[model samples]
Target: MGSFTLDDVLAVRKRRDSWWTVFLVDPIACRLALLVANHTSITPNGLTRLSMVFGLTSAVCFAQELLIAGAVLFFVSFTVDCMDGKIARLKGTGTPFGLWLDYVGDRLRVLCCAFGIASALYARTGDVIYIVAGAGVVVLDLFRYINGPQLKRVRDTTRAVARENSGAECVFMDELLGASAPGSSTEEVRREFERAGDEDGRELVDLQRGFRAQFPWYDRVRMFLVAHRVRSHLISGIEFHAAVFVVGPLLGAVAWLWTSAVSGALLLAFESVLVYRAWLATREVARAVPVNEREKVLV
Candidate 1:
């Protein structure tokens, strides 16, 4: 029931570490790209467009039965998708417009591949599994959108806490993203820093620098990718590819008996992970305070 703000979104971005790192390695590479975007005045929407271009290519590759190339481009798209918002935050240029574009970009790219994969597999086997997979993809997208409001709340609270107490003493749980305060926004914090003396603002910057230094690059990358918001993307991608492409349809084509067994196993594994993420999202919603409390804090 808590009212929300931009900080909440950023927090979700940070919490991405909780799930994203396990499936992908060297996620820190994403930050390098973000850093470039930040310095260049490239809008988040531009980054989103770039991601879509690559994502479409990735999907096309998959459609043409270019699995390896598709997989490679898909990963590249993921990296860009992950980095764009961070770049926006670093440059203090985040906008609702850009954010909206980013969201649509992700959906377009993901759904494009989902539909392509389903069509391809359907053509090959007519087993209906690919269609089922495509339907699941649609459901997942709905889940994401329905869950987005709560995710925003969680992110807001985390950042508010970070600003109020200072992130230095904050120990981020594996659950949420940063050591953000429960209700603070980036704008509020930036204003606070600006109103203070030059020395004080410098100290705050130094604190931020120190915080970044404390975490090794690998750990940071792991955290960024696994952050709660983005976790589903990585997990879902792996599950779909591993199950539908590798285990189910592919295996079924090669060997029927083994295919059924592998499909069952993969389904069980993927569903379990999906359920866990659902629980995590529920827990985040539970922690959000009432709207009145959020308003008071903001006021």
Candidate 2:
């Protein structure tokens, strides 16, 4: 219940040890780029702006149905996306304002790109379905931003208030460590318990630790899943543009059939899953107990 800062949030996120590196294959390379950027006096916001330009360019290319160019640009844009945060962290210049701007910028880019693609695709094939699908993607992304952390904050604040009023403070470590899963080792759980710093809570910590450590390769798999999923969608989005624009004359009928069937189905499925996960993540975040003591305690 203390006043939280960006540093606190970032530290915790860092501790989670993202498995994205396994899928990215060049996570450290991005980090090194950030280091170079820092030495050259580059700011995180600058990198963020650069990423925006690249993302916008990619979207423009997709709208024009320039398949190869769009594909290359999209990846380049994402790579730039990876660098912005690293530069911020490496230079120790992460700011609340900057973070907010970056978050909003990403959403804006998504919305704009969707509009652009829809417009271009429509112009080519005169199909309303392409526009609808593009709009749906934007809506899904918007929902993710709105219902994700915002909703989670509401849930957590409510829980914290309820527990505190009842003379009980919920500790996240207690819940995380105590969680049990099948096929976990004992020693691994013990270490996690020790880290929690409460003898009474050690048992659960040990168990949770065991489960996490046991799946050493799980992070890699998870990252692979994320990259594969993202790349697949990117391809689908591009293909829709292709069929609607580039091949609209020769493949108009076939393209409409495929776009309305394949891309629509996949996009819906992915969006549904993403929305559910976003909701769950928000709820979990709302439950996280503040650990630092320097800030004023809300409870």
**How many clashes in each structure?**
27, 5
Q: Which candidate is the best by TM-score?
A: 2
Alpha-carbon runs more than 4 Å astray in model 1: 1-16, 21-28, 34-41, 148-299
Q: List model 1 lDDT by residue over 184-299, tens digit each.
A: 34344444454563545422322122223344453344344433334433334344334433334343333422443454455446555444443443333323434434343232
**Candidate 2 structure quality by residue, lDDT tens digits, 224-257:** 3343332212333333333332333234434534
The lowest-lDDT stretch of 10 consecutive residues in candidate 1 is 202-211
TM-score of each: 0.50, 0.58
Model 2 lDDT on a 0 to 1 scale: 0.49
Q: Counting only residues 3 or more apart in sequence or on different chains, how many pairs clash (N, Cα, C under 3 Å) in candidate 1? A: 27
Ten-residue region with minimum lDDT total, candidate 2: 202-211
Local distance difference test scores for all models: 0.51, 0.49
